[model samples]
Target: MTNFLVSSFSLSAAPRNSVSRIQQELTIAQKQVATGRFADVGEALGVTVGRTISMRAEMSNIEKLKGANTSIAQRFDTMQAVLETAAGSGENLMSSIISNGSTDEGIATNRRLALANIGQLVGVLNSSYGSRYLFGGGKTDTVPMKSDIVNDYATSQASGTVDTAWQTFVTANAGGDPSLVTADQMKSFLDNEFAALFVTGNTDPALNTWDLHWSNASSSQTQARIGESDLITTSASANDDGFRNMMKSYAMLANLSGESLSDEARQVLTSRSVETLSTGLSQVTDLRSEIGIGQERISRANDGLKAQTFILKVAIGKEEEVDSYEAAIRVTNLTNNLEASYALTARISRLSILNYL
Candidate 1:
């Protein structure tokens, strides 16, 4: 009587539900086998899921830092190349000054050379990396130096403040001829007037010349974070004493080339230009060293980050990783269970009261 009361709906529904559940478990096991990780990490890890999340977050951060380090290393390399070019230009100018810059012919030749070097130096200082001006300090979006500064100075040499100052010196000394000007007088003009033109932050309109003509760089240097707590200077400024001194050397030569000078005055100019250029070149070398040091620190930081990345991966593996062998065995068991359930469902569906009789 109890067997006669069995319902057809209950017989089919039980095996149908069993097949559906086994299919779902098989799908999960197959996924775990393929990925070698938990199919439901949160479900499996429970409260320990937080540790897995934290480790994955740290891994993501390390990857981002590694990418940043790569970009910073490239920027440092570009800066090194530009500094090398600037140093070469300075050396060429120093050689010209030391060799034969005092004679009229030599002055003309050296003036042309200095002009060329000025263009080259300006081009390098105004150099860019991915739309950012490398020498602009924090003002990376702006051009660091005037591209036409050399040309502008050349065009205005006769009409600008430099000529005005020279005219005043001539009037004071009561001399119409530049050849009649003494070395000490030329020294005063060079040290006082010409030097003023290149000086930064002079309130006087005549002396505030560098800002007006040449440099647009910020006084602040560019800095970058290579690590969580490590910040380093990443760029050189066009307004640095090194760059300004270099410009001073080139400007003095180019502007003075047209004037007829006494041998003593020319000698004084050449000597001073040589000293300025040598100092500038030395400072350029120092800047290169600074960039090199930053590069070294980045290299060391990356090594440490890589080590941490490896450690974090191992730690995460302990919590989220699944054994592929075990997962494959589970998949096989689930597949067999699903097939048996499917057969049972088919048998239950074919059941009839007349067949049982």
Candidate 2:
């Protein structure tokens, strides 16, 4: 019989080594597959996480912008309501003036009330949003009207008795043809004319001077218009449209006080009031309409932002989240690979020189 020498045996280590290497590779591949990221850990971990965080931040910003848009829309709606009230009050005042005329005490009372309403409107014009006034025309904090009382009438009215101090101005500048003055020249003339009228120690001592008193006894130095018509002649000339109309209206009211006005005169005054009120109302309506359009645009922009945020959220999820089915599948594959590796390692352990002997 051949000498049967049962030497100590061991399994070939190659199979065990191959199984361990395969298991390590499968672990790495499983991590990549489960995370739905690139297989290279050196590059994908930081880049993918940073990308997801950035996308989340972008989505948060879009949501915040949508909230801001909503707030602005609400503000616009409130402004529209206020403007509507103002327009309605204006219309009511105009109708009353047209129907009652100057003979009616109610008309005068209503006119006074309308003036008060205009004061209220001025306050609304100075309404603010975040420290910015709405109607200040870019000078947000500045009030447009001074509302101080000054002797506007006696100082501004052209005088025939005192050689018309403005005559010197005309002679010095326009050769006595006041109509030759342009709009800017007229504005400059009116500004200086008002200063001369109100300021003490005038260059022309012969010019007529007047002291101004307030409508209310409590308020000192308040210059009230003589009448609705005085608004025009109170200045050297009717220069500004708003100031001119205001003076003319006041002069008309003054002329009608305590006197019976002719129907024709009443009709003219009523027409003028309506025209002015209508023009102001049209401007207010146009502005409100523009705000409404802006509100709509803001709403649309918010919707777009929300949609974009949703898309970004989806993108972020795609970049970072593990797909459940895919991850489970990879885990199952890894488990099977691990079991095979253990079986191969066991078989290799069993294979030894003693078994061959």
Candidate 3:
């Protein structure tokens, strides 16, 4: 008791829509085969979109960290080379003084060589990388030590503030011999005018390079991000006790070079001078050792960063990469479906009103 009415136009339109959908699927599969990565990452990763995005971002950050770490490591290497060479020169100067019976000319000549070596060391300390001074701390644009440090020292020591005090103490109390200056007098001079040159950090406006007005001692150092969870620091300046003691010894030895004193005075000066220079050598040696330790830490951090990068790459690849074999199979199936759709459409289009009747 039911009458069925079906329009040919409606029937044709429904098949056409199904054929269009099959063609669209075929196009997507072909694109997946051509590009190893999904054409639509969000559509391909449906529920895992957030996680894939995070992993990719982290991998990008790790790449940037690796680049920065390479630069820090280079600075560390240069630091070690300069420190070792300076320490060696200090040690050599002390050794020559200890085993010398040469004339004042010989001593003076040695002092001249030492002065040049000290100046070279200062240049290394102020070395720059890409317009930024290595030892300048937060003031990378500024030189950390005065260019005329040796000259300033000569002026200060000769003005009776340091040399005169030592000379006066030795003359009055040291048996009329300048070389016989006692440790008390030496320490006193160092505590007063001597330490004034370097101690408590050079905050004087007159001495801009030696100024210690940094946010913090460590702030003067370079902090590098080697990994997601790691930071490495390295820095050194003329104010470091190692450099201070070494430069002080050099200055004093240089001053003694110009003095017209007896062999007894020279010998006395030489022995006492040898002692201080030896201590400076020890401090510089320790700084070189610290550089070795810093290099080791950076090496370890680099390894960790590499491992993290690999893990992130693997995770991201799984979410975004197209499976070549699977994609090929899907392409074949879609092609067949499209061909069948075309055949059906042709057959339907061929069926006119007369054929239907």
Candidate 3, clashing residue pairs?
none
Per-prediction TM-score: 0.87, 0.50, 0.72
Model 2 agreement with the true structure over 1-357: per-residue lDDT tens digits: 787654323344565666778677677667767666546533555645777777778777666666656656665676677667766766676677667765677657655655455455444544556564444443445443333422232233322211254456556767775444444543454446423433222345444232121111111111212222221110001122232233323333332222333444345445655665566567666666766766666656666776787899788667655666776676687778778878877776666666659
Better of 1 and 3 by TM-score: 1
Top TM-score: which candidate number?
A: 1
Show where candidate 2 strays beyond 4 Å: 1-44, 143-263, 324-357
For model 3, what is the error of residue 293's alpha carbon versus the real structure, in angstroms, after optimal superposition? 1.7
The order by descending TM-score is: 1, 3, 2
Scored by CA lDDT, what does every candidate get?
A: 0.82, 0.50, 0.68
RMSD of 1: 3.0
For candidate 1, the 10 contiguous residues with the lowest summed lDDT are 150-159
Residue-level lDDT for 180 in candidate 1: 81
Deviation in Å, model 2, residue 312 alpha carbon: 0.5
Model 2, C-alpha of 241: deviation from truth (Å):
9.9
- Candidate 3 at residue 53, lDDT? 85
Pick the lDDT winner. Answer: 1
Q: Sorted on lDDT, highest at the top, how do the candidates line up?
A: 1, 3, 2
